[model samples]
Target: MEPHLVTDERLRRVLDDLIRREPLFHRPEFGTTRADFAAMTASDFWETGASEQRYDRAYVLDALEERHQDPPVEEWETSEFSCRELAADVYLLTYTLVLDGRMSRRATIWQQDPDGWKVVYHQGTVVQGS
Candidate 1:
């Protein structure tokens, strides 16, 4: 691990907490309904998809609802998690995700709110030649 990837004890806990939620919106354990998804995200949440297209909260939520209507079976492996605090109660989490042999680098900005963790933003870039 590089020095920059090393997190302090306090951040380590945050890292672990956020890791389980990585590749966010995929974990039914955290949320499955559109309303649940909405609660997990900030009002202005947005994301850059692996397709390099930017989507806003409304579009993303609608898409999520449609997808979960008949969710496809996906098996993904996540690793190389690293986290850094960007500001008070806010953190950036980065990791690699491998699904069906295709790999992508994922990053999610999360904020610790009174309710729970809320996603501020998220993005996924497919790794070339993976």
Candidate 2:
């Protein structure tokens, strides 16, 4: 069976908000629960300038806690994003995150459940040229 693809204004709005300044992931005090995970699977993440990476529920929570000193929000621009269906209820969204004149390719997989859209996977990779 083919996975169901999703393309809705509401979903885009929500995703845009999450990637904007003061995103939930950067908030140390933000609450993250198991509901955000898919079967407690450890998500993959690659932060800019990081040589190695590990991301899971606890890892993300701890990282947020350690990021208590929030940096001043930089002016950022995001390119048009595209989405594809990965499974019955899972969708993969890919876009470019532009900050400080640098662009990073960002991809996130979200799953819809009774609790709404939950991010099951996310990754950001620095783009070298063009």
lDDT of 2 by residue, 1-130 (tens): 9344455664576445444422225432333333322232334432332234655566665554455445446666777566666787676686777767677777776666665556666677777533
Candidate 1 stretches greater than 4 Å from native: 1-4
> Candidate 1: how large is its RMSD?
1.9
TM-score of each: 0.93, 0.59
Q: Which number leads on lDDT?
A: 1
Give stretches of model 2 more than 4 Å off.
Answer: 1-52, 68-71
RMSD (CA, angstroms), candidate 2: 6.9
Candidate 1 versus the native: TM-score? 0.93
The sequence of per-residue lDDT tens digits that candidate 1 reaches over residues 5-62 is: 7666779889999998877988999989999999999999999999889999999999
Show the colliding residue pairs in model 2: none
- Candidate 1 residue pairs in backbone clash: none
